[model samples]
Target: MQSNTVDVFTIGFTQSNAERFFNRLEKAGVRTVIDVRLHNTSQLAAFAKADDLAFFLQKINNIRYVHQPLLAPTDAMLKAYKKEKGDWGVYEGRFLDLMGERKIEQRLKPEMFEGACLLCSEALPHHCHRRLVCEYLNDKWNGALSVRHL
Candidate 1:
């Protein structure tokens, strides 16, 4: 099936409090939350911890929460970026390769983006894997979906 346009949103909660974070998603009318973090259960997540976030999404707005760990960068890859001060270009290339190897483009259901949002921990899309994921998807999916970074 071909979609005229798929609205895939992206967001991160680093600089946001729980209320504002969830509020943004709610206001956007997000029906699904695709957690693209390697460690969704980290204590640093506050209210966005795996179980709690899933609970809250359903309880607050009937939004579905999905943990797509495969979408996350590997620990080694992330270490190279943060701990080793790796070049953004290198990181981007590596991450893109990983996504292709995972065949995520083929596996992803276009219907899922009807009212779905991609999630990560960064405050903004710059230098974030979430942004790369959206860009890759937008291109590979033949522009069926346009990403809106929230």
Candidate 2:
């Protein structure tokens, strides 16, 4: 696992299963969890908000948590992407631009761990914007990034 070969990774927390998600994250040894969901509140009462999740993670596992709305895709950007990519081509560039301009890459470069993971509320990576974020980070910053479901 070369540091230059791998960038950030992503994971989802849908399907109403917290035990499985947290277990996988713990097993992965993820030290920092970045939540990219525009709205962190979930319909599922348990995972309702990012603050609560952060508190739990910090108190129980000592993992750092951050909610980065700048990394979240905006509605305008999504519409433009849909038009440009014809709905299926995930808008990787827009997100990359957002993260890059906001210094997210610079900020994350030093914080990235072997098990760092970006989180959202989509069950599957393909069904979520996280796919685009992961793709951009993998293609532009590092090549070995992986997106997984938990």
Candidate 3:
């Protein structure tokens, strides 16, 4: 690990199977998985259910799992984007504002993100808050964080 560089990874479980997901994390040498999902307990993905994911992560790869709801968008915000067909630009603006208002950069420790993977439901980071979170933190920390999407 570089003294001045903090490496962070991001991933989405959607369109991924248990084998591929776990293997990817293991291959990436992830030490922890920080779930950034608003509704993690949903039945959408059985293996990704909060309890099951934690258990699987530990049992399969010995990786620590944490659910950090503060990293997720609010239910209303998500609803507007998904259910109401709101524009991505609007959603992005609102989410970024909310993160600033919540002061996640101050509340979340940079050390915790070292060797950690941010987990979301999107198959790709393009439209995911996980990507925005990484960019936001990198900006706040003066590009100290090196983010890699897996």
Candidate 4:
């Protein structure tokens, strides 16, 4: 790895079982798993529940877990997109604006994300805020982060 490059990863647990998820993180050399979900304790996210997931990650993969709701979209934004079936473009724009407002580029230390994987509930990264967060920060950091989806 280049000295100036940050190895950042993003993953979603919805379509995966616990075995696959933990194995992927372990294989990817992820040191920290950053929970970017607004609500991680939902019953639907069984294997990915905050407490249990953290415990599993440590025990199984020797990985650390940290939840940062600051990287998540507001509840209203999620409801509009998921429940109301709102436009992706509109929701994405609002989310980008929200990220700008949060000033994550300034607030989140880059060192914390080094060798870190961003976690969400989406099955894939294309439509997930974790992807947006990665792209946004990479831009801010002049492409210093090399983002990989797992």
Candidate 5:
């Protein structure tokens, strides 16, 4: 991604206090939150289901939520990763296809907001698929993308 062109931030809810997480997001002025978890359900009750979380987000006007199953890493990808680089290359390739062929960038790119954040259950970006996703986006955008952890 080009230096100082656009910024992309990755954040996780892993073991973090939910209230603090949401509050930090609010403080960050994120307009759109994309949930990347293949299984949106979490063992933790607060982040368990998407519907309830979406409803809570709706209460905060101007904040939108979306889930992209295409972007989510599949079981097959996980299994393959175990035997391969385990760097999420396969999933990143699929994500690029979705963004390019499926026109996900055109359909879901944030325009009204200054920033967006990808959401998942893991708190560490490097340990999560969001790192690969961010790397893909960074390459696609030709270094115009920046990633920050929140």
Candidate 6:
């Protein structure tokens, strides 16, 4: 293997049922699920509720769960993006800027991503910050991690 080639994954539960979601992670050999959301307990989230997910992941799949709010966009940023009619390009730009300011490179380590999956609500990666998180980490880690959007 190369010097540091960590395996990182990203998954969204919007289009997936609880069973399918857990299946995906298990199939991918995911050991950790890093939740990148501002609020993980939203009613719309249902079974994916932070505490419930944590328990289910561990009990059912043996996957550890961690919520990293720093990876989520601020409420203000989210509001602005929605106000723009879901312009993904603008949201991407603004989110990237926020990530830079947060110095995500320094804050997150390759170890935190090894066999880990980034979780969010967007069914597709196109409009999700989890995709950006993967891209940003892939670049910052100098290709040290392989990111797969599940």
The numbered model that scores best in lDDT is: 3
Please report the TM-score between candidate 3 and the true structure: 0.97
lDDT of 2 by residue, 17-82 (tens): 667777777877778788887778756547537878998778767888988786688767766764
Model 6 residue runs over 4 Å out of place are 1-3
- Which rank order by lDDT, best down to worst? 3, 4, 1, 6, 2, 5
Q: What is the TM-score of each candidate against the true structure?
A: 0.93, 0.71, 0.97, 0.96, 0.71, 0.93
Q: Name the runs in model 2 displaced over 4 angstroms.
A: 1-3, 77-86, 90-114, 142-150
Cα error, residue 143 of model 6, in Å, equals 1.4
Worst 10 residues of 1 by lDDT: 1-10
Return whichever of 2 and 4 wins on lDDT: 4
lDDT of 6 by residue, 1-150 (tens): 475688889999887788889898999999999999998996666779999999999999999999999999998878878665777787899999999999999998888788899999989898899999888877887888887888
Off by over 4 Å in 1: 1-3
Residue range 97-143, candidate 4, lDDT tens digits: 99999999999767778899999999898899999998888788788
Q: lDDT (0-100) at residue 132 of candidate 4?
A: 95
Model 3 ranges with Cα > 4 A deviation: 1-3
| Candidate 3 whole-model C-alpha lDDT, 0 to 1 | 0.93
Query: What C-alpha lDDT values do all the predictions have?
Result: 0.89, 0.68, 0.93, 0.91, 0.65, 0.88
What TM-score does structure 2 among the candidates reach? 0.71
| TM-score of candidate 5 to 2 decimals | 0.71
Candidate 1 per-residue lDDT, tens place, 1-150, comes to 345888888999888998889889999889999999998987776788999999999998899999999899999998999899999999999999999999888998667788899999889999999998888877887777767888
* Of 2 and 3, the candidate ranking higher by lDDT: 3
- By TM-score, the better pick of 3 and 4 is 3
TM-score winner, 3 or 6: 3
Q: What does candidate 6 score on TM? A: 0.93
Can you write out model 3's per-residue Cα lDDT over 1-150, one digit (the tens) per residue? 457888899999989999999999999999999999989987778999999999999999999999999999999999999999999999999999999999999998778799999999999999999999999888887887889999
Higher-TM-score candidate of 2 and 3: 3
Tally clashing residue pairs in candidate 5: 4
